[model samples]
Structures are given as C-alpha cells and as structure tokens.
Target: MALTQEEIRKIITPLLLSGAKMLDRHCPRCGSPMFELNGRVFCPVCEYREKQKKTETGDVEKILKEKLNELASSLPEEIDELEKHLRVMEKIIELLERYKKLEGVK
Candidate 1:
C-alpha cells in the first residue's frame, strides 16, 4: 500500500517536470509567460512585487525560529506548573483507588 521513495520519485518527477514546463509557459503570479533566468522562475514585474511582499513579512523560517526560541525560554516555568498539576491529578487517582478498595469493587 505504501510506495518506496524511489517509486514515488519516479512517479513524481515527470509530473514535476511537466508542471515546471507549464509554469514556464504560464506565469503563476499573473498568468503570463514566465521567463527563466539561471534556471529560476521570474516574472519581471511580479518579481518586484514579490520582493516587496518579502520585505513586508520578512523570512518565514527566521520569524518562526525567533518565536520558537521565545517559547523554549518559557518552557521551564510551564513544565513546573504542569508537574504541580500532575501531582494533584495523582493524588486524585490515589483517592479514587482507595475509595474503590473500600467499596470492594474492581
């Protein structure tokens, strides 16, 4: 039921190549013909727009990493809270177990 990596690649490569050719024939941004530059896709006018968009939002991965670092720094405090909550839960479970034993029910 599962495809091997090689088999998946074999099936996907033609589709990818075809899609690239189609994209070269038709631009994704404006539905105009795409001009290839050094094997990279570019629509001259859209390129400036894309750059502006990037400037507006910056790199996604870098932003994600900065957020992740902020969260990671807070994790020790969160873990301490979680451990306290877990201890409370364990106490509740022990009381339930003792109640069941007193009731002579399994």
Candidate 2:
C-alpha cells in the first residue's frame, strides 16, 4: 500500500530536521556530528543544542576598540599612583642627603 502524503510528511519531517549538513560540527552530548539550525548547533538525534556560534557574533575591531578605550580611561589613576611614589622617593632622597652631611660622608 502506498503511504499517504500526510504519513510521508510525518516521517520525513523529523529526518529533515535531524539531517547532518556538511557545515555541522559535533553533538555536545552524544559525540555524534551536529547540524546547523538558525546559526546554532543542533543535534537532532540526541536533541543537543548549542547557542549561536561565537565567530559569527561580533565585530573584532569594535571589541578591540572598547578594550583599548577601557585601558585608556584608567591611565590617569595609574599615573597619579606613580607620581605619589615619586614624591615619597624625593623625600627619602632629601633625608639621605641630610644624613650624609651630618656624618661627613660624600
């Protein structure tokens, strides 16, 4: 007996969703290869799911620029700390010179 169209569809639907494409990677749970669905990894057989691929997500240059800006914004605090350290060193140097004079040491 020939299968009805609805019966064929019911059978084929699941197979199509689970079919492995050439671009598919691997299933996170079963170690079987995974297929791509809407840019995310999908393992139809095992029902595994991975979120969108990382490489497909963001602008590299924009990310770099944001990091650089973060670094740049923190520079003043670092410079202030270095300048405070320099002042302490100058005070130590002055005291050393005074001690040398008192001891008649060059």
Candidate 3:
C-alpha cells in the first residue's frame, strides 16, 4: 500500500530527529523519499519494513551463532553431558543454516 503524505511525515519526523539523513534516492515501490540511518538506506513508506525485517533476521542469526560457539567451548568431559551439549549446538546450527537459506531466497 502506498503511504499518504501525512503518514510519511509521521514516520519520518522521529527519524529526522534521531539524525537520519534524507537521501537523494527514492523508493522504487512507492516513489517516496528515502533516508539513511546507521548506514542503512530505506524508504519510510516503502522499504522501511523490509529493511527492519532483514536487520532483525541478521540479529537472530548472530545470536544463534554466538550461542553455538558458547556451547562448543563449554563441552563436558562426561560422555552423557557432552552428548546433550552437542544436541543443543546441533539445533542452533540448524537454525543458523535455515536462516542462511532464507536470506538467499530474498
């Protein structure tokens, strides 16, 4: 859905206040102006949600990898406990791989 001018203002005001820079580029989907925040450029009306989803997905991937690394470093000497830890790490690895594949689809 295309955003009305007032809707765009509602979204852009806080971004501008927070130091988001208005860009010369326009959104291909909506023809609205784009802004850059923390090096990510997007349209408040069009691409903002897409950008946010990508950023959130990236965060989740990072967190899963970190957890897997932590589990790897904490492996137990006891065979039973080691198996449990390996199972958890395997799940995390699977999640990370799934996310990587989803990103490729995008």
Top of the candidates by TM-score: 3
TM-score for each prediction? 0.28, 0.26, 0.63
Q: Which ten residues in a row have the lowest lDDT in candidate 1?
A: 1-10
Q: After superposing candidate 1, which stretches have Cα over 4 Å from the reference?
A: 1-43, 55-58, 77-106
Selected candidate, larger lDDT, 2 vs 3: 3
- Cα lDDT, all candidates: 0.51, 0.49, 0.86
Per-residue CA lDDT of candidate 1, range 1-106, in tens?
2334653365435445665432437545555445454577665445545555555444443554465455445544567886765565566556555554644541
Candidate 1, lDDT over the whole model: 0.51
lDDT of 3 by residue, 1-106 (tens): 6777676677878888999999998788887779999998877876566777899999999899889888988999999999999999989988998999999998
In candidate 1, the residue pairs with backbone N, CA or C atoms under 3 Å apart (3 or more residues apart, or in different chains) clash, namely: none
Query: What is the C-alpha lDDT profile of model 2 across 1-106, one tens digit per residue?
Result: 2334563355435556666353446545655545565566555544311122223223443454465555445554577885765565566556555554644531
* Predicted structure 2, TM vs. truth: 0.26
Per-model RMSD to reference? 19.8, 22.0, 6.0
| Order of models, best TM-score first | 3, 1, 2
The stretch of ten residues in a row with the least summed lDDT in candidate 3 is: 1-10
